[model samples]
Target: MKIGIFGGSFDPIHNGHINLALSVIDMLTLNKLIIIPASSPPHKEISGLASKNDRFNMCSIVANCYDGMEVSCMEIKRGGKSYTIDTLKEIRSVYKDDEIYLILGSDMFFSIKDFKCSSEIFKMCTLCVVPRRAQETDCIREYASFLRNIGASVVVLDIAPIEISSTQVRERLKSNRDISKFLPGNVEQYIREKRLYGLGGEYLIKEYKSILSKLLDKNRYSHSIKVSEKAIYLAKKYGVDVRKAELAGLLHDITKQMPDKEHLIMFEKYNIKLSDIELKNKKLWHAISGALYIKNILKIDDEDIMNSVRYHTTGRENMSELEKIIFVADFISDDRVFNGVETIREIAEDNLDKAVAKGASITIVHLLEKNKLIDHNTLSAYNRYTSNFI
Candidate 1:
């Protein structure tokens, strides 16, 4: 009996997973396909993940609908970090005589060489990959050659590339938006029943109250409120999403009052890899960690808002309209006073584009003059945005 292995975090199974699995079965004529959920993905911090049991149960719910598909708790039951080689070896043990095929996305295919015992995986099974829509076939062929050179049998299956991704699904779920089209009806219902990503609004409100009640200095809290008000104002001015800008502004300093020690703890817990500058300053970690905390604990689902909060202190490039609004609002809020305060306020009021470009240019020049590392994103923003001014 030929068997296929499909492995993923499967946080909440969606139609994309089902479509990919069916495509593989049809293309490979595999007798059975095992859907394995990882116990813990080594690359990511697990704190943000749904419980292992929850992931497994969701995969099980999706798999039971198909006759040839079965959900395996093998990785979840094994516990600890999951490696593909170990799971493949286990499957080989169970179906000794059967040919095995590993089904993976085109994105995962590029990273195969980095996986634990990737070479062994190829020797044990034929690797079946579906192409991603945006990826070039030439790139796939290049990697396929590299794999073949390493003694791996690579098979590229032709299937309609599903653009749906778990990240998009998670984002949609957080907004209390309809995910029925992206996900299976049952899985969509299950997520709502469990209330997985619905905590953003309440969490933000609670954190705001907590900051007001305890951690924040009165002045800082006042600045936060002003930033929030300005952010909402700018959101209206720019026609960006208003609710997201308000939430981002309100929570931008959620961790500002945390003791340095507590802030560092959150950084470690979130696995936020700091740049050399960020590591040296330590102060900057609060913004990055605060964004993650809001996302994980507060369940903020709007990426634009979360990113705005994260990059508010040190603005980065290609900022969304919302990100730019929050960043500029933080700079020119009524409490702010500086050499260019009046000019910045005028530019902001009359033309936000000029304000953003001027603000970003000022920040870049300041960082350069101070001999500090300018964040690449900030520079990118300046380059893309400054062309209009020049």
Candidate 2:
């Protein structure tokens, strides 16, 4: 059996790495390719590098797409300066009968002479030189010829060049560019949700979670989590950004931590003009207060998220997609226990407009039955939907 050994830092393995793995497997017609993610790369600094676990996880993510490819954490398990010589010796011990091939790019091929126990490495396996499109073809040929002169076995394969790099991936994520085009959907989702590589680095999501935990009561905090999950589901279904939806949902009830008097105080502090009936209603203050607190205190400038938190309780007319999502999410969250909740949730599955209109109508009727004051925005929101849909 011919086995290929492909190793790299795979800091944040991108499409290019996946392409290379696929090409090498097909070109060599290998039975199995063992992909090694470096635990501690001696050549490169580990400052911006992802954790060993993350790198290994990303490698596994790519390996899943290609048959006969496997991710081995040998280097990581070995720990401390992942020397190629050691890895080869360990593999040699396992598969004594199989023909081993070591895959490297043109860049690595040129510098292999400096590798620890370089001579012993060649004896262990044939150095498969995968030419990078960035380098000159003539230079690659000349290097291959030189390696032959020095009595090293080398196989140069002509593979389609995919120009993506991990650096480019990191840069795109840092700048908030659309990197979905360059990464697998699952990998992209992991990076986005974990706020990896500075996508949401400006604000510490965990820090906010901690602050929220300290502020909100147990029940209210649980409700926030439920709303966030429901909002994320809706966001994904409706093609809205899931990250934004989650954040909006988390902050939607930020003011719920405050007492009734504090909500009233926050309302007046923010210069909000509430109706005579709304002034006495503490329940109506959290939505408006949450929006203002996150915007002013948290310094969040995202209007989509701000509006989502603002209108989550009392949805307004001509609401944004995010606004509608939060409004529906709050009403149908898992913690909610009321009549017709299941009906609105079912309606939400197929029709957002219908759900929003129905939810607003239900809230209005509930308030009227109690002889409570209804906010004008809430009334206007219902009228807007009825006039348009009806």
Each prediction's TM-score against the native?
A: 0.52, 0.56
Task: Compare the candidates by lDDT and give the number of the best one.
Answer: 2
When summed lDDT is taken over every stretch of 10 residues in candidate 1, the lowest stretch is: 198-207
Pairs clashing within candidate 1: 316-378, 317-377, 317-378, 317-381
Candidate 2 TM-score versus the reference: 0.56
- Residue by residue across 1-390, what tens digits does model 2's lDDT show? 999998888878888888888888898899999999988877677466578888898889878877898999999998988888999998999999899999988888999988998888878889998877846567877888888777778888888778888888988877767887789888887776666776674345556788899998888888888998999999998998888888898889998868877777777888888777567777877888888899889888999899888888778898999899999999998888799999999989988877898889999999999998888778878998767777
Candidate 1 lDDT by residue in tens digits, 38-70: 888777673545778888878888888998999
Candidate lDDT (C-alpha), each: 0.81, 0.85
Report the number of clashing residue pairs per model: 4, 0
Q: What are the runs in model 2 whose C-alpha is more than 4 Å off?
A: 202-390
